[model samples]
Target chain A: MRPGRRIAGWVFIAPALIVIGVFFLLPVLLAVGLSLTDFDIYALASLRNLQFVGLDNYLAVLRMGLFWRALGNTLYFVVVGVPLSIGAALGAALLVHSRLARCRGFFRVALFTPVVTNLIAVAVIWKYLFQTRYGIVNFVLGRFGVHPVDWLGDPHMAMPTIILFALWKNFGYAMIIVLAGLQAIPDELYEAARLDGASAWRQLRHITLPLLGPTLMTVGLLTMVGYFQLFAEPYVMTEGGPLQSTLSVLYLMYNQGFDWWNLGLASAIAFVLFVFTLAATGLLVRAGRRKGWV
Target chain B: MNRARAAAWTVNGLLAVLALVTLFPLLWMLSVSLMPQGSASTFPPPLLPAHPTLANYRTLFVAADLGRYLLNSLIVSGGITLGALVCNLLAGYAFAKLRFAGRDRVFGLLLAALVIPSQVAMMPLFLLVRELHIVDSYAGVILPALASIFGIYLVRQYARAIPDEMLEAARIDGAGELRIFLRVVLPLLKPIILTLTILTFLTAWNDFMWPLIVLTGNHHFTLPIALASLAREHNPDVEMLMAGSVVTVVPVLLLFLLLQRYYIQGLLLGSVKR
Candidate 1:
């Protein structure tokens, strides 16, 4: 690696670096700058409206009623959806990794199928499936003599329905990762546990779960990062409707940026979301390291 | 032995049933797509269509605007796949084996940046694209993804496996840097390129949020967008929606089926952090 060859290396990689810098890195930095000032469509007409407001946009977004509502909805989604996602993934992994699971290839493919499907298409199908009047979900409820409830049209039900969709769409990803983890565990440990008169559940708690900590941690972090970016579900199935109950932070940023053309406020919201993800990821890494898991 | 065998059998039985549960909605989607109008919602939830028909497909092609959406998806996905492959491969090779200034620091920065969500860039990026006057164009959607950090990272990881002596010998033969890259490196990197190709294609093909915001006109909508629009337009037409779903999923599904070995291998390689 000579000094002149060093120049060649940079030249070879320069195009990608430049593009990402312009589109990705520069935008991130610009977003921070935009958040500090008052920029909007009005500002676009003449640069006069763009004044340095110095945290004014963040203060404004924080004080706005809709912003709080969106944050609450996003938190509700992450709190509920994250656990459901992990739980389903764990369950599916257990079933598939079990000794009795014959034709394992077929089962793995079947479980992973939903993950690769288009979210928009599936969310569309799910919306109709849960429709209040003629939906098969309500129809099945009718058979059980339970009253029909509007799943997407009701604000309370809308977020829950979206969470369910998220869980279904995503759980398989973690399932595969965990299954791979399970497969990596040595069989001798389980055999020894069995010989020691440990029950199936006990063996699982002591051996299987402890070994799976790293995989689950990875799954958890990825799921949290993904859940924080909840937009497409609300956009498709609920449209952040029924009193804006399903409006995630990303969704809020979008509506503000594109719909209202309030770039400053939207950029603030984007920065806030990024900070939240950073904090959450940091906490996850710390916890993993503390537990000697990472 | 007998007791353990029975338990394993029971476990296998449960898994088979669970697998069926997982696949039911997709299979039902297909069945409903083929069912005659007003035929999918009967009691007992028709396991199979009484009489399968291609009317829904015909309706999608002729009545709905899905064909245009499909074309839009093709252009967007194809452009990103081809463009990103070139950028990522060149950068990856440079990062892996070539001598570069600030190489380690730059690669490390890219790795660290992976933790940051891309949505953070969206607000300003939209404004940037709008300024460029490429807003709502295929280029606007395609350009951002043309150089993916993850793709470069994946290729770098694979490229490291190429023995250094091979490159050294090429250098000893007085081959130029790009010549060594084209002749010696790329041929060894074929399998990974194919894997990355499928991965990038699927990712670009399935993108929803960005396109949803950028492409405002129906003429520029992708298949997912069109399906979503049609679902909103004709909510009562379950069969029609199913037909749209079939259109949206079948090509990627076929591609996956054909190249599953590589797909799974790519997944393992891309996901597992070293």
Candidate 2:
């Protein structure tokens, strides 16, 4: 590249860089700063009430039982949701990858269709499907002598319902990624395993999982991170639920930020979520390194 | 011919059942949408409607103001696609081919920024929008989305594959950078641009979270927001909600079905490790 051309390159990129830096980076810094303060609706009208309380907002979030409830709900989503989603994805991929599978392309598309469908649209469908009285789900359950359950209205079932919808919508993504991983695995490994009299289960445990380590880590971490940002499902399906059972931290943050206009407190909540996500991501990476997975 | 073969078929057959279960809700949503107003709530739960009608769609267009929401979605999604393409293309080109001070460092910083959830910035961003007095306006919903980090990353990877010798030759011919970019680089990069265009539009169109929070009014509400609100208010109107679901979901479904290859390829590209 010529010297004059280099200047043009910088010029081409400068506007976007400036826009991102000012609008995105600056606000994030301000949010971190604001999280340390007690900026509320009062502070919104006037800056006089905006006094820096030095971790007071964070402490308040810690003390709030709602935050704990939201955290527990989010963790429940992560721990259970991630595994089930990954398992479903893996199961689907295995089927698609199998030699016995015919019309593989059609099944792949059918399974993946849900991944790209509008979340709000499908969550609405799930909400209605899980409706307590006259719902298809309960109606089906009644055939087996099980009574109708208030899925979204019951504290026990609300989060689980959200998790199920999430799995249905999301697992296809992991399936595609894992299918790619499965394809990348050398056929020779499986052939060698078969020659050694290895069963399918043993081959999967020793050869498939071991060889799929890096992709598995990436899949796990990505799934965990994605699941933690749980908002639209609960917001649409349960509205954070009958007992706030489906309320993830991000949903609570949005309710606080937009509904109550507690910008400072919401920013604190967002930072706490960021901290939790970062810690989880960091732990995954550490574990990956320790196990030589990456 | 053998028990093992039958067992394998059984496993696949069970998976086929599971696949149908997964897709049943979406198909049922459409089925209900086509049903008459109260036909959706029945005891036997008809697989296909007894008497299908376009009345629900007519209702969506006339009574529910979904026509306006559809227009808004198209405009917002179109504007985002146009703006994101230019910004991502230029910046991605710069990242891939350009030389400037702190180029690697700036790129590294951007990569690091990707890890921080956008929600961390959401609170401060809302405040900034409020201060600008642009909250609830179209600009609030569109501006921040115009330049996505992921879009840039996608374009950078695509642009990096362009032959550097061609750009050098164009520069030697006394063509300006912008002209060369427009005439030379862009034509060569057409396929990826199309892919990114579809992706950015679909993402912005189907986006729920930020738009839901920022655009609160009925007028400003996008398709997803309008559908979500309708779901809340008219829960009993299963036909109406299903109609709304079809309205929100059908366009993207068509787009995906038509361009499944690009969409799927782009999906794998943006996410999975090569």
Candidate 3:
């Protein structure tokens, strides 16, 4: 290329490169450095107050009881939420894909409304719906002679309630993706199955499931990673309360970094969360490959 | 209904019922937002108000100062959209078309960087924002979001399909690179530009965590942050909270409804690798 054109190319790319390099890439590298120090409110006061602690932050995070509890809580959310979300999405996708279904566009919009709405706002609506004494949920259950359950107030129930909320808010996204996958399946395969005297259930098992393996794996991975970052729901709905049952690893990191100004510890927590997400994604990919799905 | 028809109708009926269940909370939020104060907390929570009114919405704007937060959200989201559009489009176009040394290598590096989640950089980014003295300012939120890897990738993917021969023709006619980009390239790229705009705007508008951390004062709080803090302060006022929820949710919902084809196209474009 000519010098003028080469300079133009450089100019075109320079602004984005500068911003990403400074704000994103630089901070990631500096976060590693920050994680090695004993940075806190004292360090915030004076740069001189900071002390390089050489993996002490990671060690302390691993040793802390709250860290483990937060990890467990986050794991519970991912383990329970991802499957339930994928199940709901798959069901919705199949129903929408069914020949019998009517007003497909309307159903798609209605289901997808939750995904686009502001999370904090919908979380507030859910907070009231799950209220203890006068909540609509319990009020409806009362008609069936069932007692009221403290949905968000009970330690045991808080995580479950949040899980239900997560499933509701997110399934639409997965459904859309799965729907695309469903549409890509060849009609000849289903025709061949029908000729072989296969029932609908058998068709779904033998043909649809196998065909959808890659899509479902992607859906599962995305949902699991998203669920692992469970902060906003508990933050808005329960405040990580009711004996801290709703506290997630990301939430713990937020509290440590933003609330307490323990930047080093929070950086360590963020790395741990990253590692968890990476390993989970790797495992799912490996499992999918072993089954000859990907 | 005949047997097969009955079965199909049964499936449709089941789908309708499920859709209703899915929509109930949002519909109830709208219904309750118009109810008299404290009426939503009543037993068997009224699905619709007997005497509907706009008192809660009025309270939100007048008493709770939600209008200011809405304005703040608009400013922050709008600024990010415009800035991110320029940066991502330029960089993405350059990546797709412009020949330079190490271009593919740099693009590969950017793609690899996508694996490092944004939250990992939050602590240091916060300190960096603090040092730049942009903490609690719109700049702090908007500046950091001006160049996302996903946004750049989306534009690059779209820009790659633009025929290089057209650009070469323009250049042979003595059209400078900037002129060709502005007149010829941008017109052809209009569809993807609209998709990128809507995607960036919605993401910026609905973003919570970073804005929550950066903006310290109420005057600067976005709608999500304001609504979150309001839920904490006015925990018992169900009608008011629903009004707040409605206000926060309606605009984006309307946007999605109107431009759903483009939105869904963009979503599928991002997700499915062809």
Candidate 4:
């Protein structure tokens, strides 16, 4: 309201505005410019070598077969991992939210423990645990007359193994959110359902799931966006291999950018990933609106 | 009555099994870390060490120089947390309480920019840092993370509940805005402050990709980056690797356990409140 207060407001926000503008907003704009040029190791050695090639970087990215494979790998991960993760979270939420469940606090903390641990640390633990010969997973299966499966070493099994690891590492986050949503539902609805001689299945089908539509949609959107950025798991556990089966879009970008110093190509790849993420978010939001959930 | 009792038992039994499955890997990580070197590489790998020893931990600190990386992690994460708190708190409060021209429009622009992933900015940000001559230094890792959009949004949501009447009274007494903020607003924001501190510390400590790219030298490597490089090395020493994992994971894990109430509360506030 006062002139002094108005000046004070500007001073208060100045530090944050400077940092975001210089570091985040500026780089985003620069990335677009960087993508238009052939900025590689030669350019890194000398700025004079940088050549503005227009859309050449984007065109090269689209024409590369490895880029297609990486895109396909990322899509497969999201398509498979999103539902599995949500299903696990919802199941765990229902169990923990049950009136009859005991030690609810213990179960909640135990389930959430994985979410807090460092991703690199836990991925190391998983890589050792799924080792073909000496891993506990294979050893346990061997006793049941099942042969030891090369979980990380096989081309076909690497992505699935990485998906399982992602599911385990992440389900706790959505579980906590879903639990909050579950708590918000009034008990009166279930009580009313019971008065009509409803079965447990019928009560869930008719009431709980419907009421939870928006929460599930939110969880699905967040989980899908996260899953599409699958880099660390493959980087640590499989190194994008047995046959590049687990190579994600982000991993491909990392290799192109850092490993080879192909900055322009990497910038193009980054925009491609952003475009996919935006498309997915737009689609989800539209679906939510159509269903009147948002 | 008997049917109700049976259902309760069934539910609890199922929960116990699920908890065990969920906790086993982490428990095994701790277990394998303590095993004698090479003992864990045998058939049907042992769940617990036969003769538990600190040999692996000793190697990590002594041979691998993990203590230096541990110290690096503390410095980087702590720096980012403090800096981000100051910046986000000031801006968030301004957005919620202060009046400025085009304030809402600027806030709208920041919110829209949230969709662009951090990776999109990494290459140019790297070059920018290189130009500033801060690359391969702690400042390189700490500068870009000095503020975040989510942090400001969190603080704004919490600070909105502070009553305007109290601020008006302070202004009437000739208290400057800074004095009023320091004296009145901060104490009321204690809960969100705690939530934001824990959230920022954990995220900074666990961040891998950014630190890996920026901090190129081994001396500047944070715990996660150091552990990743070590794992990728041609080392088959499983026990030692597990020990490294333990060292990397335990601090944040313990912090989460101690302040889980605040942590979970923040999680709900961040996700569901919107």
Candidate 5:
């Protein structure tokens, strides 16, 4: 309560408060205002051209087919990608956490390498690996008598390919978290189960799953939130191409806001994405609570 | 016992295969970068180069001008790391140690704001930068990074563990708050500061969307932005693109390899506490 301490507190926190206030928080508030106006390149040239359109931008974005298509693409990504990643993470965690497993350190690093690698760079590598004719993915598939599927070049396949790439890159991160959760489970539970003649599968199904509920919920929510903002992968890999199947909501916002400079429409798309994110997160939390995991 | 041994073999075998699958793309990237020009586009898709060379790397630097982008990335990321460290440390320490009104309320606001994805503010943030005439400049890319809610939270969590009595001892010895922070608290927070530095650097270096939006010309491009633009121009040149990937990924990959403990700890500390 001393004046000196209070003043020091204010001084220490001022720089961060100012920067975040002016850049992050202020922009968020301004975005809502910007969304309600017809702000475009013309407005950029002259502020007098900026017109207050109220909720028209939001209505226009709602009616726009591209916006809906982008939303669908994003939803398709989250719906499929979240489960694929969690499954892979759970499997990898179980494997690495297995008593029979060896070289735990090596395996962990190798798996996690992808998560830390440059997105645009790895995306480029993936583009090559899935490059139809000369691509290694198709080349390997041919050995199995499976024909070369156009991974990124086909509309239906593009989103799936992106999903595959995402799962591969991201699962390790979740796996590491799950592995931590796995380790936290006391050894006596397994020992007790073993003495009772319960199988490893039974132990995992009953004990591991029940205990890992909270961790899995958190992982699932984080993965869903992250996947909803898919941008860089498709930006570098497909450019939302092959009939725009890989175009995400964030990608749409990027194109509208940056590429086209339609700040109003772009802000509306951003908010729409925000709403979906909130709704999905809320649903997950509710589901978690209903299951008594939270 | 035989069945148990067999199960162990199966688990290890699957793990080996999984590790291989995970690392195959990155390994192939290194190999293709060494392959002779146009060799990676072969029928079997050669795993390694017949006559290994640095020609692709040479072309990346000399012909593609990746060196400039690399320097730009270093400057921008370094600037951000240093600036963010100072700001976050001061604020985080203040939130943890100093007495102030509305401190908890403001911190709670920041925690809530974390749910608002950064992309939601990108449109107006970009416009704001333009109004400030920072667009197409490195300042635009580096300035926003000076304020990070997550960074502040991370530092605060670590700072709270610095026993208050140590700070009190320093204060009683006629050391001012700023002096105590620099002379007394900083030494205790070295590990965390390093972790923050690495995280901020990696995030800034690998950052794509913001840089791509802000940096218009090739002159100001970071590695990721430069590589993305280069991919568009040289999509068919598989070997060349791999070389670009290597150039873009190698620095961060090396950094992670060197500081794996700090990086992973930062990740776990940030996530598990949630």
Candidate 6:
């Protein structure tokens, strides 16, 4: 390339590159450094109080029972939420993509509305809807002779409630993606199958599922990565609470870093969360690759 | 033919039920927002307000300072959208069309870095913002979000389809790179631009954690942050909170309704094309 062209190239990219480098890349490196130091409120007051503690924060986090609880809660959310979310998305997508479906456009838009709404706002709305005494959900259940269940107030129920809220909020996104994948499958394959006395269920099992493997893997990875960052739901709905049953690792990090000014500990938690997300997604990618689906 | 009709009815019936379930909360939010204060707190949680009133909305705007928060949201979301568009478009076009040393390597590095969650950088980024003395300000919220890797990726994916010969023709006509970009490339990138605008605006408007941390003062709080803080207060007002949610959500919902075609197209292009 000519020098002028090369110079122009750099000029075009320089602004964005500089911003990303300074704000994002620099902070990530600094976070790793920050995690190693005892940078609490005292450090916030003066750099003189900061101590170079070197993995002590990570060790402390490992030994903390609350951290373990937070991890377990996050894992439970991911384990249950990811599959259910993907299933909902797939179900919605298949319904919308069905040849017999009517008002596909309206159903698609209605389902997707939650994805675009503010999570904090919706979580607050959900918190009210699941109120123990006056909630419509329990009121409806009462008609079936079932007693009112404490949805958000009960420890065992809070996490499940949050997961349900997340599924409602997010399924539309993957639904849209999966719908696109579904559309790409040729109708001729199904037509041929029908001619051979194949049922819709059999066609789906044999052809649709296999063809959608790559798309499913992609959706799974994206959904899992997103599910791992479970902060806003619990933050708004439960406040990590009713015995801290819904506290996520990210929520824990927020409390430590901002609320308590345990910046070092928070940074360590952040790194641990990042590592878990990376490892989990990495394993998914490898599995997809081995199956030749990615 | 009867069997086919039955299948159609079954599928459509199921879709209707799912749609209703999906949209109920938002519909409920709008419903309860119009209810008389404290009426929604009763048993069975009235589906529609007894007397649909704007009392809650009036209270929110007049007493709760929601209008101020709305303005803050507009400023922050608008600023980030405009700035991010310019930056991402320029860089994304350059990566796809322009040749420079280490260009591929740099782009590869960015793609690899995508897996690192943004929260990991929040602590130090907060410190950095404090150091710059922009803490508790709109600049702190807008600056960090000015460019995103995903935005760049989206633009590059769309811009790659711009024919190379067109750019070369413009270059051969004595047009500068900047002029060619402004005159030639940008018009072609309109669809993706719309997609990015809607995506960025929605993300910025709905964003909670970062702005909540950065904008420490109530005066600078965005709609989401303001609503969250209000909801967290003791003896919360249900109708008023729902009203606040309606105010926070309606603009983006309207935007999505209007331009959903572009938004969905962009979603597919960004995720599936790769």
Q: Is the docking of candidate 6 incorrect, acceptable, medium or high quality?
A: high
Clashing pairs in 6: none
The DockQ score of candidate 3 comes to 0.79
Candidate 5 regions off by >4 Å? none
Per-prediction TM-score, chain B alone: 0.95, 0.94, 0.96, 0.97, 0.97, 0.97
Candidates ranked, most accurate by DockQ first: 6, 4, 5, 3, 2, 1
Q: Write the residue-wise lDDT of candidate 5 on A1-294 in tens digits.
A: 346776898899999999999989999999999999999989878989999999999999999999999999999999999999999999999998998999989998998889999989999999989989989889889999999999999998999999999999999989988988999999999999999999988998999999999999988998999999999989989989889999999999999888888999899999999999999999999999998888
lDDT of 2 by residue, A1-294 (tens): 557766886788886787688678888888889898888889888999889989988999999999999999999999899989989988888888888887788889889988888999999999878878757898899999998899888899888888898999999988988898899999999999999999989999998888778777888888999999999998888788878898999999998988888888999999898899889889888999987887
Tell me, by DockQ, which candidate is best. Answer: 6
Greater lDDT among 3 and 4 belongs to: 4
TM-score of each: 0.94, 0.96, 0.98, 0.98, 0.98, 0.98
Tens digits of per-residue lDDT for model 1 on A1-294?
445565778887988898899999999888889898888889978778899999998888888899888888988998899979998899889988887777788888888888888888788778867878767778788899988889999888999989988887888888888888999999999999989999999998999998999888888888888898999898888778888888888999998888888888888998888888778778888999997778
Q: Which residue pairs collide in model 4, if any? A: none
Alpha-carbon deviation at B232 in model 4, angstroms: 0.7
**lDDT: the better of candidates 2 and 5:** 5
Tell how far residue B248 is off in model 2, in angstroms: 0.6
DockQ scores of the candidates:
0.62, 0.68, 0.79, 0.84, 0.83, 0.85
Model 1 C-alpha lDDT per residue in residues B197-249, reported as the tens digit of each score:
88899999999878877888887888998887776674458888898998898
lDDT of 6 by residue, B160-206 (tens): 99999999999889888999999999999999999999989999999
Candidate 4 regions with alpha-carbon error over 4 angstroms: none
Residue A228's lDDT within candidate 6 is: 95
- Order of candidates by lDDT, top first? 6, 4, 5, 3, 2, 1
Candidate 4 local lDDT, A93-141, one digit each (tens) = 9999999999999999998999999999999999988999889999988
Identify the runs in model 1 with alpha carbons over 4 angstroms from their true place: A1-4, B1-6, B38-47, B234-236
Residue B103 of model 3 has an lDDT of 90
* Model 5's DockQ score: 0.83
Encode model 3's per-residue lDDT on B201-251: one tens digit a residue.
899999999999999888899999999998888455888888988888998
lDDT of 3 by residue, A63-89 (tens): 999999999999999999999999999
